[model samples]
Target: MPATRRSSLAIAAALLAVAANTAPALAASAPAVPNAPMIPSGSAPHLVGPHGEILHSSSSNWSGYATTGAKFTSVSASWVQPTATCDGNDSYSSFWVGLDGDGSDSVEQTGTEVDCSEGSPLYSSWYEMYPAYPVNFNDAVRPGDHFTASVTAGDGGSFTLKLSDTTQGWSHTVKKTLSNAALASAEIIAEAPSDASGPLPLTNFGTVDFTGAKVNDKPLGSFNPDNITMATNGSTLATTSPITDSKDFSVSWKRSS
Candidate 1:
């Protein structure tokens, strides 16, 4: 499938899910807002290798590494939440690890978010079974907090998503089921959050470093994942560094939108 269409479908599914769960009065009072759902922006072509592996790709909303061409049962990563620099314009960003949503519709993911709201940085954490609205965690998230997250698919479509903040001493584990999940991809990414309209402006997160990234109990680099850069309208918004030691990399922000 074309990259643009794949991304659009993901966002559309999330919107439908949100609409279904909203009450008429609430829906009328305010539009449903997504909590840092991943929405690839722009229409960059995916460069495929001779072995059907994605070599490199670009997205308007995502930057980092994603491994495809396999059924991913587990994915995990750790990072320190990057601080966001706020300005007059509102912007949003997230750091996450997940399975699927690269070549298929469903994504089982959990992560933290830093958003510029009214010129101030707001930090939060959440998990989402894509096509379903994200559920926010009430625990506080702060810049520089060390966070570890993982997602595992179990028998009969059961799935477990976990996120923890070592700095704050809080953790959450959620169990959900998605019988038709494709489990097609695994990713460790930094992203610009989206809403029904489209991707929101990316927050100026400076940089976030991810370590111990693994998929299926092996280092993420073992699969030679695609190196993804975030861009829009020919402008580079964020860049991903080469993975070091098969498990470490960083995504640096260059622009807000």
Candidate 2:
């Protein structure tokens, strides 16, 4: 649909947030089903973050799905962008995660229309999602310190990531898992696009196989698949929304707890 980004630190905060506010007993209760929602019917496919024992997904402001196929004891939504068609009605390739059983719950949850069209930037909007719980992370990272690829999804999909920082800006290593194969190995290559060069392709995370999986799993703006790192200099990291506009969408950086 559009460019969306989530970091390990951000996911950590979400899990920690959930742990801090949730009742111990409730958090411990075993999930009866996989929480991953079905594919959302958007201009394209998109991904939803994972929740404990559940996957979250939604399409527009009306329908949501839970896979119930794969269950986790404790989960934080996370995954790498896929390589597939990334243009009109093709930008979003797939999405997983659940919404409240009641349709239209996301609108109230985030206070914005679930439908997001390109060129439509929402300054600040809230999609109130009824996730099993909020997944927050711990506050342990500092500027300048970093690592490379910390693992996203390992099932059939896996990715290698990297982080870079400088007085000028920051960049995340880019690598991706092939449709049906885990990205055996990937190295981030910095190739910024100039006015002449078209959008730079994300650094190759390595290649495995892709027979039936969608070619472009993620759209261009929805994420920095180009492997461009974020700069924290001068610009305040927009961890929380600070303005009001016409968009409200949230992504989960998943990790199993």
> TM-scores of the models, in the given order?
0.85, 0.18
Q: How would you encode candidate 2's per-residue C-alpha lDDT over 35-93 as one tens digit per residue?
A: 11111323332333443322222222112112222221111122222222112220111
Candidate 1 residue runs with Cα over 4 Å from true position: 1-44
The global Cα lDDT (0 to 1) of model 1 is 0.79
lDDT of 1 by residue, 111-216 (tens): 9887664565667788888777677786767788899999999999999999999998999999999999998899999987666455668889999999999999
Best candidate per lDDT, number? 1
RMSD values for the candidates in order, in angstroms, are 6.6, 19.7
TM-score of 1: 0.85
lDDT of 1 at 175: 97
